[model samples]
Target: MKKSKISLETSFWAGQEVENPFEFLEVFFEYANLDYYKETLNHFLLHTNKLEAYEAGTPGQTFIIYTAFRSFLKACFSLKTKDKKLKVRKAPEKWSILGQASLTSEEYQNPFLVFQKAFDEKTPDEFDFFLCEITHLSLSPFAEEFEYDFITPFIHLTKMLDAAKIISERGIKKNKE
Candidate 1:
């Protein structure tokens, strides 16, 4: 069966205006699937494919799609270190994806964005910091972090995958209704 192409972008943004941003994270996670990630790793891993998929063969919708993704992310993840708690610093309608944040490709793995950033000067704390930054998912216990982890990180990771799976199932169920 042919699935309907639904751009829930406007509604997604509207939700942000009324509700706490992260409240819609579960839905965001659905769109942030294999085709949705164009930020860092997804930007590189799927750049060629994204372009090739475009019949115009130019970066047409790419920029628009990217803008929406970044705006949503910047709204949700743009944080500032204030005392101990990190607070939202910017709620930009359009995020500037200039410099290193922009995707460039010539080649590629299971490229780990966190480990790849490892350098001599950076400390282990910084490693943990970057992990939270890249995932945009905090591991801080008091940050009211989502209950992803149970016994180990593996369990948490499993739960995340399962959540994604459930989201797919729910979509199918709704479409049938």
Candidate 2:
């Protein structure tokens, strides 16, 4: 019988059991504690993957999606000492044209304006492949933190926003008719 090797990164980050002991945890902690690394981890773990459930645009899924994102943002950026909360405000009307907040803010920066600038610098053609890859929906959760997978929530948020916009437009059209 063959035994499986334990995950070093998971064991180190998630405090899971590992076969080999990590000797330099103090050294590792220094890098892991940095804001840059934390942001990098957030970028990949919390904002990368798309969820199939969200993409399906199924009823009642939107609420769960928003809940996940609210929990994720609160968990990652919440300041327990001062009780500061990262407010996930609704994106203003003017910002709707930007390929939705779900995809942009994750990679370039947390703030929407910075992400807009970064996204604009690159032509759409440059990102076609990358965007296509991001749109591929999978049932699997990308990464778990604080007891949940972080990325899918943001994906659901974007999908819900799009659905809301479509419904609003249809209502306006009906009123005009």
Point to the candidate with the largest TM-score: 1
Query: Candidates' TM-scores?
Result: 0.27, 0.19
RMSD of each: 19.7, 20.5
Cα RMSD of predicted structure 2:
20.5
Q: Which stretch of 10 consecutive residues in model 1 shows the poorest summed lDDT? A: 106-115
Cα error, residue 129 of model 2, in Å, equals 33
- Number of backbone collisions per candidate, in order? 0, 0
Best by lDDT: 2
lDDT, candidates in the order shown = 0.30, 0.31
Model 1's C-alpha root-mean-square deviation from the true structure amounts to 19.7
lDDT of 1 by residue, 1-177 (tens): 995432334353334432333334445564455234433333322223232333234344444444344333332221111103322222234534331121212101111121222222343334333334323321111223234321232222222233223323332111121
| Global CA lDDT computed for model 1 | 0.30
lDDT (C-alpha) at residue 77 in model 1:
25
